[model samples]
Target: MKIYKKGSLYLTEGGEMRDDLINIYKDAPAIFETIREEIGKVVVGQKAVVEQILVGILAGGHILLESNPGLGKTLLVKTIASTTGLHFSRIQCTPDLMPADITGTTLIEEVEGSKHFRFEEGPIFANIVLADEINRASPRTQSAMLEAMQEKQVTVGKNTYRLEEPFFVLATQNPIEMEGTFPLPEAQLDRFLLKVFIDYPSPEEEYQIMERYTGHAEPKVERVITRRELLSLQQLVRDVPISDDLKRAAIKAVVSSRSWEGVEYGASPRASIGLILASKARALLSGRDYVDRADLEVMARPIFRHRIILTFDSERRGVTTDQVISEIMKAI
Candidate 1:
């Protein structure tokens, strides 16, 4: 592996020694490993899920987690914030949720015998935001998040409020419920960099979970990285070098998702860009300076699963989006 001063990594032919990208690669994994260890203190099992979430963070993108209730979706976000030492805020989406309920509102307040309007920042202003059960909110309320998710700024009234740096939104939705939930529009779904599906833990992991939580025992979690360190890491991730070949491969994988058979709509250009950035982060997490085909291939499913829409034929035949994605991966 070659570590470059510009934060670009390259793999050597022998895979024994890095030429110029070794320094950049060395600093990336320590931050990730420390975060993993800290989160492990509180969260049990689902290690892959946690790592993928970290990848999303490193990629500087939002994540949408789909799972049933009580799978620790909310806890996972909270634990991530705690472990990474970032400010955390949560917004519970409901039928009556309003735009201002998330992005903040202007209020008139008396100051020195004079009334003036001031902007009060909402939960979305924090470094890490957990939009719990986001699908339950109405379309109007949900659309309010569009600008913030895409532009990293919330427009209220005539003024726009720029969100803090290193910002991330980890939204969760209940997969089992449909009656009271409003499905996220396709445009809104495209904003997420990755859609992670949280599943049940294994038998042994479940046993460990039970034993750990029995009799009012609490899991100990420590903060591993500070806010400054996290911001620096995010900047470093952006500086990581990606070759044109790997970049084109990422684009090809995302393109394949849309044009595949039995697909109504494929991923958008934004999805392609997201895949490239996410693959870089994933490679960095594995202590590799350069991104390989394996990184892009492994990340294709999560990066494009939610972005693609299935056709009626595929849906009627019990074909899942993930299954179609697997086929696309094989074809690619």
Candidate 2:
């Protein structure tokens, strides 16, 4: 499939070009389903949240999870890591957490009668990093992770270290408790590709959860796809055809969020880029050849939710950022 850059958007030829893209997308569901099946072995319910995380991974972006305690946010990340056969690391963010604690630290070590600085990598170096209760950490410590998330590398004492490919940071926050919690700054929030809001499970799902845990037999989860396969899938998503019309619509929708009434700040250009990237992944998951308006609409909530800032007036009226974004989609 040949992609041509026209103006600020990418377009592909209509007939054969579309078919090739569709074929690649069709193959994704099989792999995605296999991963879902593996995750199901350990995780009882919350299929929607799991799907969102998969989308983020395929899109090669990070995720921010907002949910109440004991909703299995950490378990979901762990399950994903285990199912994908990736190295998983968990960091418990706390008030006393320091930048060096999450990133690496440089220590002096003597070698051959000479002292040399050795950099010890932290938990962020793993393939999958689950940052539990991220809001509890101090701002400085939180800021330290921003560079790693965006650039996929960490610089310690003038030495830079690149992270392994297929890196994913699934950070969770407790929404019910805000006391002594340092909210993530807007800049850091923008780095995340999606903000998934996990709600309570259904009655049937709750029963399944109870039954699954009550038994002494532990559910075994097998790896569905290797790390190399995931990396290849990410490349495929980038190569997926995106029509000019759909790209424009994505940009317009992101622009609308910023200028929309009840919003304090609109979505940035980065939000627009994120929407396009995420929409491509969503399209692939849905077995589509190219991104469409529907794909953009389906992905709008998670991509723009954390990017848009609601005004005080909107907050007073109980108007949420999602509502504002929904309105923009309708208007567009």
> TM-score: which candidate is best?
1
How high is the lDDT of residue 32 in model 1? Answer: 78
Candidate 2: misplaced stretches above 4 Å?
A: 1-27, 111-114
How big is the positional error of residue 286 in model 2, measured in Å on the Cα after superposition?
2.4
lDDT of 2 by residue, 23-118 (tens): 444567787878888898888778777877888999999999999999889878887888889999999999999999988899999999999988
- Residues 187-228 of candidate 1 have per-residue lDDT tens digits of 999999999999998898888778878858688688887776
TM-score of each: 0.91, 0.91
- Candidate 1, 37: how far from true, in Å? 1.3
Cα lDDT of candidate 1 equals: 0.83
Instruction: List, in order, the clash count of every candidate structure.
Output: 12, 1
Candidate whose lDDT is highest: 2
Full-model lDDT for every candidate: 0.83, 0.85
Give the range where candidate 2 is weakest over 10 consecutive residues by summed lDDT: 14-23
